[model samples]
Target: MSLDTTTAMPTNGRPIPDPVPNDLTLPQSVDVVVIGAGIAGVCTALELAERGLKVALCEKGDVGAEQSSRNWGWVRLSHRDPREMPLMVESVRLWKGMNERTGAETGYRQCGITFSVTTDEALKEEEDWAQILQEYQIPARVLPAPEALNAFPGLTAPIKGALYNPHDGRAEPQKASPAIANAFRMLGGTVHQNCAVRTVETSGGKVSAVVTENGTIRCSSVVVAAGIWSRLFLGNLGIDLPMLKTTGTVLRTDPVPDGPEGTFKFQDYTFRRRLDGGYSISGPQTGLYEITPDSFWLAPKFFPALKSEFTRLKFRFGKRFVQEMKLPRKWGATDRTPFEDTRIYDPQPDTKAIDKVYAQLQAAYPAFQGVGIAQRWAGYIDVMPDIIPVVSSTEGVRGHIPGLFVASGLSGHGFGLGPGIGKLMADLVTGAVPVVDPSQYRLSRFSDGSKIAPMEGILRR
Candidate 1:
């Protein structure tokens, strides 16, 4: 099948990529039932299937329909929370080989990334983080003022310095997960789209099987990489995963030649060179926080996270509050779930915010002056208190639910971190040695006495 998504925006109105045909026949048994076909779930299933495990990959919507395909697509290692450095290093390695492994166009390019700092305080913060990277033996350096300004062509912004990592990269979000999922299918794995797993049926405090909308799938274990819907899914299993959702608006411009060599970030906005010659632009810190029921419910737990992200966020309380307020917390297997009702969690786009960021991009870089926006979109990014992901077993903390694993609360960095988390989760499920240390990503950090905090100065994803 010819893949033609040139005009598709992966938003609500436009058609997203669906290269991976749905596997309608649900198998009676599989060694693992991987829930949610976003990057996390799809990559995890691909890893397990490659390891000779019978895996069933299930999704409430098409693969990469939600945040997976709707992100800024910056596969960077700069300014990451120190805890994620190891996994990010692994992710970069996996990304380097993703196209070769899948035999598909993932648009993975090691074009480098620059976290530009226009203020002295920001430069100092960037220097501190660069030191952390140095300690980790990661090649990240803070460039001086003139060096930073000269690095990005057609630049007019007075940037003091920047933390640059040449090994960082970018990828096409619309193609990554689907390519990996197609590779999984070619390997004889099964995929079920529009399949909402209502709950995991447990036996003797351990997971026995997963009951989906279509039928039951008997599996030894289940991995929930359900993205924004993970908290709700876990709530049904009597497990609580504290999460808050933020809306990030993004737009792609018409192809502009010689804008910049790679991805560049300013305080107000971020722009990356896309594989299509166009640039994906968005406000990095201008994430709009839509008030929901979870905001108040998880306030105490998320207070510190909010404090760090407060300056970069804009708040609004409207219909989304009511929409989330009415969602049922618990539901039976046969009953209809919020997941089935909303296959694509495409929220309303904040065009005004996006337009403001676009104006800034044009002012800083002259190449974007006359570029027309090809498409504009938005997505709800789930965030944990630590602004990182929880890629651990359910039994890690309280043994509340055995035979279950979670890879959620990725904040806005899920797209870049997906493959590494997928590989890590697969290792945990099979009882194999992990690719990186998983202690920082444990779900028990909230309940346990671990000092829950974001990396230096509490940065947002």
Candidate 2:
């Protein structure tokens, strides 16, 4: 659980050569060109390489520098869309066994996840989710407020009830990301960091080459897994992705005696079981967000429903922070950058937002009242209009674009289910029977009138 700052530096600076490739003048060809080095891209490349494919993984920033490393490391399946449940289950399995497979410490812990609830309606919803889990034979149960309090002796938040899932867990996103990327390299996959791929060449409706700042590299297949920047990468094909940006501002406090002693879970509105000894808490709230329409450069489609949602979220922040006077709260935004436009946005953590979050944290956790504040920052989570991932190929784009595949639109839920989606992508590419029905995630779902009805409490806030 130690935080090592050294591994993060490679994401910046000049382009580096692939570990296996010595000649720099763009390799003539590869079986697959995987774009973006985050969880989605790295997982996809690792899966593909495991299938014996020659894979090339590219990244514009440091590995996992974006949302991959900048997320709450909760690996739980409670309150997920029905369609995504299977993927979440499989991802949990992968996460549980990742350390053995990759030989890297990922800080994976099956400590389970708990959602503290204050209202009867929310409890009913939790019961409903329990039914869903029961049907799937997944271990889920409702823990009443008193029971939850007993589970976490020091949890002082006022709670009427809570939901617990024994099978769910957590992992260090920062550690897991690079571990998986390194696993991909061990599988003979080539990774190119700080190598911004610009244009992709297509002929007869298939991808023929991928053009980056360094030069053109021949590729039969391409996977655009560039988190929030996915739409920008596809813009060259005149395709406007219906992706949006959601911001999450998180902060860390100085290690405290009761740090890792609290519940190894998170409450719905605020709080998470930090792997680094101390608990990290946030208001049970989803922060600011914006959507992209038909153009990457176009103004965001501010979904009107979110305003009221933010209001309630603000109330939650105030309520939670009012009780805990020690925790600090930080805040910031996810950006809207095209792949070639990384220079257009700021990668630095938002200090202003961090200060705000610090104030909120101080009010929430008693142990955090006089604790020294540590690091804090923000990251963008890409959301779809329907708030689901778009995993199938680009529709109506012609024959395979040869190898141009899309596995994005995670809608802020990417980290938890990333490994499973990557495995699914590999199965499709390798002509293996898919583990789950991917039809639910087909790219056409958006335009084909198969919208994911918005979760009442999700989008509006």
Candidate 3:
């Protein structure tokens, strides 16, 4: 595949093996209807099925087609918010046994992840944060400058030290979600592709079912793991979910036999070794935000986050503002919604940004000098106001729509935290023992008098 930055469906990305899709035949009823077939949705369905709950996994497009597969495939516990630390710890644990649990290959490897810092201040911050990881008894430690650079070969990026999390690793993005979805199907879960869920039908403020483009499925509960489309989908239901999107561009290299082992975060760029022998590379440009109509409407909630990352994020206007304005905010259940309109949020990769990151990667690691660029792509990341996720039910609001649970706004941490989120969501839905304490991820935090803000400071890695 030629690394055409403008291509929407880049062929280089691991194509999720198309399974026996059930979009043609809609199910009559299910215990739960999971909207979106990303990592979180698929794993949630699988967990629900494992608990013997009939689940219908619906997606506007193919499984893992969006940010689920478009992510850097990094499964890490380093540099995470303390609120999510426990969940990430649980997520990493789930990641370890995913291949066996799904009876498929997820390309999971615990080779380790090294987050290098170029300054002593950053190193000190990381070291201070290591205390929380130590509380969890996670195998994470701070290494001195000399020892840090030695963790990965050819890591010539000028750095003072690093926080090495040997337990933090990666899984193949393209393969993991699809494999899990396939396993869910084998477990008797209905997998629907190209089935755009228009809206959730509520009865007396409780979710009665979800109306999809195909037909209505009488589900007791609905989990909106709709990634970037969550806020839009919820907006039609009168739920004011304060969320926004940021573009992330990633480039994959051709097979590099001697690429640095595991994942490494340079001062400007980051790379992870893939199963196919190539390395997925990205840089700070991932934080770029496009100005849309929602940006102005939700500016008050996001003002703090924007101010915190003023110098870090790049914002663009014009096209996105007009594009989002054209999207229907109020649609009837019988009408075609925007979910069907935009099957995949495939943004154009910034060619110049990719070139710059590539140049910097070669400069840092001379071993990557002549490696061929196989493919480059970009996807939008849905973020929340407090820079965390909402994996709770809809009963927190004034209108209080019951039987509706949401697991969206994972920001950029969805792929890594998918399993933990799924397990926790299933626990909440099934009234079973939670995988972790779900207090921090409640939907009420935004509406309640609780000071809705980011627990961690700027530049959340």
- Which candidate number maximizes TM-score? 3
Candidates sorted on lDDT, descending: 1, 3, 2
Candidate 3 local lDDT, 1-461, one digit each (tens): 44345334343543343354454687899999999999889989999999999999999988889888888998888778888988998888899999999988898898788888878788888887677678888868999878887856766778888889888889998889888998899888988889999999987767899999989999889999999998989889988788999988888887897777768887689899988999889998656888998989988888878777777778888688898899889999889888888887778777678769988988878778878777877888998888888899877676568888999999788899999999999998998888888989988888887777776663555
Full candidate order by TM-score, most accurate first:
3, 1, 2
lDDT of 1 by residue, 332-401 (tens): 9899999999988887667777878888879877889878777777888999988889998986465477
Model 3 compared with the native: what TM-score? 0.95
Indicate the residue-level lDDT of 76 in model 2.
75
- What overall lDDT, based on C-alpha atoms, would model 1 receive against the true structure? 0.85
lDDT values for all models: 0.85, 0.66, 0.85
Using lDDT as the measure, the top candidate is: 1
Poorest 10 consecutive residues of model 3 by lDDT?
9-18
Indicate whether candidate 2 or candidate 3 has the larger TM-score.
3
